[model samples]
Target: MNKNWSAFNIVSVVFGFTFLYLPIVLLIVYSFNASKLVTVWGGFSTHWYSEMLSNQGLMDAAWVTARVGLLSATVATVLGTLAALTLVRHTRFRGRTLFTGMVYAPLVMPEVITGLSLLLLFVSIGFERGFWTVSLAHITFSMCFVAVVVQSRLVSYDMSLEEAAQDLGCTPFEAFYKITLPVILPAVIAGWMLAFTLSLDDLVIASFTSGPGATTLPMKIFSQVRLGVTPEINAVCTVLIGFVATGVIIASLINKRRMVNNARTDADI
Candidate 1:
């Protein structure tokens, strides 16, 4: 019975992974297809990739998306780190629970609601919808993710390190820069990557907030997707999947290297 259960568990795991990844795998495969219709497979060709490069409008949207991701991720990371520090390091504050709820509220809120609220806010303030507005909206939601990631890391971190740094006569800011920042740096980077990925993948929020001249890649893809699935969309999907996969692989490698280094240090000790 135990052996049968174990086999079932293995099958379940495999099915789950296949279910999650099969669509992405198929999309990447279709990107190289010679057929214009994304559903039908033709002999492999690099035509879509070449077309992706030459399509000026798509290229421009991609560039805009990249810029938005970078800017929003950076801003979100900074703000989130500060918020995390405030939540974790500070002992007491009025409405702390309220603050925490607000910080994480975005993660739970429906995307349509968030987008609508932001749209209303922008319109009420007479802020023109454009790249900057989109960036601002991205930052609002992305920062919540960063705060959660950093907060989790900070919970496991040794506060004694910062105390020791203070004992060595470092100012609070200096101690944080020298001791706390280095320790939490990996989590910060992971948070930034998360924010970047979220910004890049955003469609609903970007759609509601973006202006005519500042359409993001996802927004552009979504608009086109309504028409019909095409090889061009598949090509874009393939590129995005490549980026996500690359980031995951690199993060895994870094973590593995860190574990090995820690094990070696333990052996030496």
Candidate 2:
């Protein structure tokens, strides 16, 4: 409990953060530059933001990314939560080791490999590769991440509460719905947010899985960057950074509050 940050730790933390966020900080700062040339700072202005808003292609890509992220994250959250529950509650089941390895395999697999495999599977099945295909590819990888997050939370969870609810006449489904689910709700929400951000930020997998008219924001930005890094792209990237940062902050606050409430409830009991 007497943990304290050493000077070395402090310096390392500062250095690490600087290394990670320095580029992002510069990008955000330069997004407002009035110059057409990305390197030149004519003055501070919102010209690029306006241009970003007016670009039809960029808007379309943003819309597609948002929808894909929402759909994939939601479905992944559900499937992942169910998978976590199964792994935790039915540990002795046949092939449990194989199941566990498979669930976490995507977490370590290269994005290129996962994307290529999914693409091949879709082609083999003759599935049209478009918005749905990209979303499915995202879900395929995102669910594994979600499972890891939710499963960690489930591992330390006491199953007695659910058992007590069941003993009091609640069905197994009802017990989980009312008892176990609430305790793990914070982890579920965190998993969903993480999945959404991953989907939004994905370029390699999206590039592999996406078909015509299914371009995501990252893919659009990447394509544009290949041509040139424009102020418009910087503005778009700044906006995305803000969006993801806000989601992360909100998720952290919610988790912190939930933990505080849980602690208070436990102390009172």
lDDT of each: 0.92, 0.93
lDDT by residue (67-163, candidate 1, tens digit) is 9999999999999999999889885899889988999899999999999999999999999999999999999999999999999999999999999
Listed in order, each prediction's TM-score against the native is: 0.94, 0.94
TM-score of structure candidate 2: 0.94
Question: Model 2 over residues 98-202: C-alpha lDDT tens digits?
Answer: 999999899899989999999999899999999999999999889988998999999999999999999899999999999999888989998999899999999
Worst 10 residues of 2 by lDDT: 1-10
- Which stretches in model 1 have alpha-carbon errors above 4 Å? 1-5
What lDDT score goes with residue 148 in model 1? 93
Error of 2 at 130 (Å): 0.4
